[model samples]
Target chain A: MLVSTARLHSVLKTAVDGIIVIDDSGTVLVFNDACVHLFGYERDEVIGKNVSILMSEDDAKSHDAHIKRYLDTGEKRIIGQGREVSGCHKDGSPIPIELSVGEADTSEGHQFIGIIRDLRARKAFEQRVRDLQSNLVVMTRVNALDEMGAAIAHEINQPLTAVMLYLQTAARRMKTLEEQDPQLLSIMTRAVDEADRASKIIQRMRSFVEKQEPQKVGVNLASLIDECVELVMLGHKNDNINVISNFSDHDYNLTVDAIQVQQILVNLIRNACEAIKDCKKQEVYVDVDIAATDVFIKVTDTGPGLCEEVREQLFKAFTGTKRRGLGVGLAISRSIAQNHGGDLFVEPYVKGKGATFVLRLPLGLDGADGQSNLASASMI
Target chain B: MIHVIEDDFSVRDALQHLFTELGASSCTYSDAESFLNFLKQVTAKDCVLVDLHLPGISGVEVIKYLRELSDPPHIVAITGKSLAEINKAFTGIKRPPIVRKPLKEECLLREMDLGTALNSA
Candidate 1:
């Protein structure tokens, strides 16, 4: 029996976890070799002292009350459960520890045995994993933004190319005229203004992708939709898709991140174009409406509406049905809309044909109380 | 003579006016097919200014078709698109000169003048 007990003691002392036994009065009765290593305290130093010395001041103060309460109520809180708590080393420095306690009815009296696992290594690993995950997300976003910048360049270049030609032509004509007629001068001025407008469009597009912060300003809905159409139709020439835009008569002006909002529009229009690619008579209609406290832009496509599978996970990331490129466009677009105090969602597919995406943005002087209705209502 | 093929009416008109300003007589065609038709019977020492994008038969296709001719005109491709975007068209034939638009008058004039000098040489 003595040899067996000695073997058991050796096993407990050499275990990975720090083991401690305390009497019902909270005084330490046994401290394993692991405990000594974990706390930087010698076995002799902790064996006869209160177990509270191993805990920080706050935990130490509450240690006695916990034992007393468990003793009086016969209730087990931490006795059977593992909890995260700080342990005080011999040098008075605090370290994180995962501790689990168990109650034993010993011959001397009731004792509490605790198994403590040091959390430093595990915590460090978790932090590293978090850092790597965030880095990956940042990399993916950068790549996406880079592709978008190229597309924006192509889009803006078309108009700028036109601007340069128009202005140069006007200058040549002005030189040929015997005297500068007011009408001719006015036309030249207007052409220059048009070129300036094209540059401004490019500037807005560059700023949108380059700047991290959203810049909010009052924007006219008509011009924004026109810009979106121009952007989507830049490279595509042969695929005959009729895009019709209906804007509200009131200008539907609102204070919001115009560039980001334009991105959402561009994404929706491009999606519409992709959807109707197969149809002989393809059509995408964009309609803007200003409600009492909100503005709604609906993009309707005459494509084979969303199938059962696609409709179920419409706004989910990487769920797009496009054959080429990452499907993060809609996901990122919706995020931008939401960030600008708006919402983007697909209305239900009508039975006969067509799919509608409703982009609802909050509109008001304060712009705080506007709420988007999340109900998908296009089933009929 | 400079033959301009561009689908965009305004761009084509502007190029025509700019050519006139630079003291060069130019003819404008809206698409590649009309220019190709004209190329079949026309005999002239001319340079072709073709836009990359056109309604029917792209500018690249026009270049490919012209390559089969005994005496193809000196070709200059005017485009807003990057050269890489249209680089595939120049695979088998002698690559034509490229001019990126919005058209710079001096660059265009110099390219045409160089082509003329090379022809005379």
Candidate 2:
């Protein structure tokens, strides 16, 4: 069925996408309503204007050359092909658009009609999908790391624990033997210590993986803090960082998961060490206070304070400020604290001074909900 | 006499030593295959301390195969994994007593002595 020219013209004018027809010289001959709306131009404003005006600055400069080359060679590079290109909006901002051009042999001469689809909404939607996919990948990878760490901890801990036990048993036997060699006993003692150290490392990994239920019990807060400090400060003494511990002699026995609390301390201490890595006079001060209803453990470091970006997402998982940090350390630490019927927070950071992390634990089980039993750990 | 099937060399030697110190004759195998091969000549009244983690056939499989014999040796499961994790392998079968490792001397000695005494009785 052949349609009349008037009817075809009205149909083209009401099309959803922008349509513009240009002559051989690149002069705009026919501009539809969609084209006018898309380019923010009136129909009369662009009828006789150069089509290059609708292109971006760089595209506008090369568009005429491209047409001249096509005319000279009679070759169609983009004439029959659809492509993604940038268009110049009337506001001078570049807009992503998909364009397909078709050439026709008209009675007047050669003419090119371009169908332009605005891709701002589509591109934004595509980008949003990509972001969500990447987030899922990151989350899955983190979860895989947690499972792997837990497996490794169990495997390594077994042998290390065995070695420690065997060494201790051997040392006991040697002591009972008549005329035991002191040198041999000393070597055996060192071996036992090394095994103990390896077991401790595996325990750290297990605690960080947080794959088990928190065994909450009444533990001495001061002793737990000391043990954590000892664990973190091991092999770090040569860095010239003075670790000062001030404990209130008051009885601070609290029902908490000792292992989880130790993990939080290790994370805090490690973070403080990283923070003060570039400082000249480095010091990490741990202060313990026993209140009427709660016990507070403050870890303060002497270094460059928190930046705006780090401060905003300090407690958020996967947002570490360190170069090689997993970023989940603080998040897990804070979670463990909260699970113990308490909270963890960064004391307002002071510039040029340092940062202080406060861990508060409740003295009683009144406010201690079952939320603490939930897993409060992550792996790198 | 007892048989020890453990993959870790240190822990394997330690178990052998502990058994020897307790005045019991024992043999050690690094994997389940060797222990299974040794089982052909093995007799009753002996105990097998098979670690739950092994290179081939697994400790659970070894236990299941032993239980098929007319007079199977008393099998004790040694593991670093939690008891609940290992218990899944013992469904519809006789579950052996599990001894957790970093094996304390008293716990292992008690388990081995109990198994030997039960077998003799």
Candidate 3:
């Protein structure tokens, strides 16, 4: 049976959504007005070329693989499901669209009719809503954390200051009375050292909570790891957790935001403390290894590691072990790592053991070196 | 003498220690209403470390009430509230000072404005 030309033309042109028909050879056979406006493609320009002309390089590569399976096996994965695809416009911008393709076998040859829905507006609206929600959450958390930090700092500093003063006075008195008793002098010296350590820890936490812009420097990851461990330990003075570091002597230097490194370390360290809670002997181990290409920061804790159920949605926001946190710490850390072309992950090394989170980064990703690579990759 | 108006007990105790160490007199109040009731029978203090977010009247309102006095204490609005709140509440003063919370001992002394206080004395 043969369909009338009028009926086929009506199906192609009078459809509510955009529809386009192409021959087996990939020449555009028909174009509707919606397709004309949705994309800046005209009938004259598109009627003679390959479909790859309207797709991004990445999209085109996948499309080639997609067609190869269908042409050889006559099997289809997306013909009925309606796949989301990218369509390149006349101005070289890729327009996001959902495509439903139906193959029509006529007496003449094989023709594919494509129905496309433009998704740009819908996606933009969805993205706007997400951004608003994210911004609101960040703003609220930032304010609360800021205020809480301020209170903790102000209130904690007073006694600390008093302690500092008394220690200073005692130190001077002990010096003057050294001939009277050396034991008292030794005791005063010990007191002074303890007070100083306490003060330093408080200062570090106070600074961390306030979150000044990090000291940007070219730092050796191996050395920085040692410093960060000591700082993290200071915050957990009362806890039984012992943080041990295993490192490679190789220079693992990178120009990065140091405060960010400290922030992540603190977060992981805190989590490690929580993980090892109630264990006989709590331990948090850190391994920093620098290979020829990458540097690694692995934080391992003793608490019953990541649960199998939680593993599926592990890195998702709002899923945290702590009741008080927003769970953005790990999420933010992951984003920071990925944005710098690094990777962050919770690695399940052995079953029924402590948890280990690994952060891997390139040796160098800054300034002239990074910019040139990004530019060349973009061009290609 | 100094009055410390703070809600947190630990913070209030901490401030008391700070004032004692500073060689100043101190009276503590958990909220504004209690502080005001005590102030009616007593005279103005030498300084007050007032928290902005109080249970009853705000820290800024307390400052306003002090401003209405014949002799307002050297009002130093020390707040652990947000920078925005402290900035808005404890601003545009020629005498005395505003100290941001997590108060450094040095900031407290600096804000005491000893030079101005001595001239007035």
Candidate 4:
């Protein structure tokens, strides 16, 4: 019996999943090595504590009643089967776990042995898959809109071409006539001007829809951000806004379309500058942070932060709070970011603080296939 | 002489009228096959405005055939397609000056003059 207990202890200590044994009074009897690691506590710290200490607040409140009910009714709820549950770490953060509980009648009384497997990594992987699937759907819809825009531009441009030519031809003929009417000439000129304006609108629409394949090349992240900041500051030379750049210690090298990425940076920096133009704080913060799979470029301003209503419409085409231009800048910027397997979003607004916009780009070249298809569709 | 090859009737007529007003003698064709069939050879003194999209034979093929002649005409590409499309179609070849539609009068006149000057030279 002594040899058997030592071997059992060794097995519990070496198991990959956490194992814990609790007595009838809910006191932890055995806390294995894996259990110590999973709970962020040492075996000595948890061995004799109430098992309820490892449970979430609500779970702890009902755990004792559950044990008593099961003991009295001889009923089993989770005693024989595995199910997902939340465990409270020593630091008080909830940890997702798959737990299976079993009971054994011993000389000391009934004891429960619980085995737990951490589900954090698997849950994160599942969430990432769901996000990618949704991104693919958005990209498909954007591509269809690009194709329809191209067709519309082509069909309408032909008629506009003919109309402009006819109007200019009429005006030229009038100039050649012996008796030219000044009012007719003026009216013809105005008509020609309107046609020109219409043509320009079409050109703008075409440009918005035009999909040029991203010429991705390796570039230093610091230098790119510096260049973009300089470009933006040049336009605001007279403004008193303070621009601060914070780059992480590690030098990041990213493969991206430099010009497109630069466009997004310039727009973001310029928007931040404009936001704080009238504010007393007059500051813009540009920060670059690196993660394992992606890099984030955050632009924070000192202006009035975005409200709920404006934030909702911030990324939609033709909707913006600014009085000067159509709000397609953010919309186009977001699409460009998405095409490169990245994302652009406004951070949650805080009252009395400036808004923050984050541009996230994947470090790897994984979205090349979707981008190429978009390029072809837009070109057509 | 200026030759206009366009599948669209209204555009072709307007271009013809515009070239006439500019005092340049011009001829028009609706497709590449007709133009190639009619014009056995083109000289350095001539200029051609060819739409990149044509009905029977593609404008790219016509441009290629024209380029092979001993003295090819000065060719200008006109298209409603985006610049990216044009660049892709003309990859690996020396691209000609492109005029996008709806055509700007000044842009057309300038390209026409440049073509005529280059051809005559």
DockQ of each: 0.19, 0.13, 0.06, 0.27
Model 2 docking tier (incorrect/acceptable/medium/high) = incorrect
Which candidate comes out best when scored by lDDT?
4
- Recovered share of real interface contacts in candidate 2: 0.31
Q: What is the lDDT of residue B118 in candidate 2?
A: 41
Native contacts retained per candidate? 0.33, 0.31, 0.04, 0.56
CA lDDT for candidate 3: 0.66
Go through the candidates in order and give each one's C-alpha lDDT.
0.73, 0.74, 0.66, 0.81
Best by DockQ: 4
lDDT of 4 by residue, A1-380 (tens): 99999999899979999999999889999988888888899988888888999999999999999999999999999998999999999999999999999999999899999999999898885575455345444654564466446656777888899899988888888898999799999999999999999999999988887644676776666767776676677677888977888873324567787767877887899899988888889988899877767889999999999988888888777667678865667877886787676889999889888999999988864533211212121110
Q: Write the per-residue lDDT of candidate 3 for residues A84-149, one digit (tens) a residue.
A: 888888898989999999988877687777899999998885575455445435644664464345
**Regions of candidate 1 where Cα sits further than 4 Å from its true position:** A3-7, A132-151, A170-182, A193-380, B1-121
Sort the candidates on DockQ, descending order: 4, 1, 2, 3
Ranking by TM-score: 4, 1, 2, 3
What's the CA error at residue A94 for candidate 1, in Å?
A: 3.0
Ranking by lDDT: 4, 2, 1, 3
User: Which regions of candidate 3 deviate over 4 angstroms?
Assistant: A1-11, A14-16, A22-28, A37-41, A44-81, A85-97, A103-112, A119-155, A158-380, B1-27, B44-53, B70-85, B92-121
* TM-scores vs. true structure, each candidate: 0.49, 0.46, 0.45, 0.58
DockQ score, prediction 2? 0.13
Colliding residue pairs in candidate 3? A153-B102, A154-B102, A154-B103, A275-A303
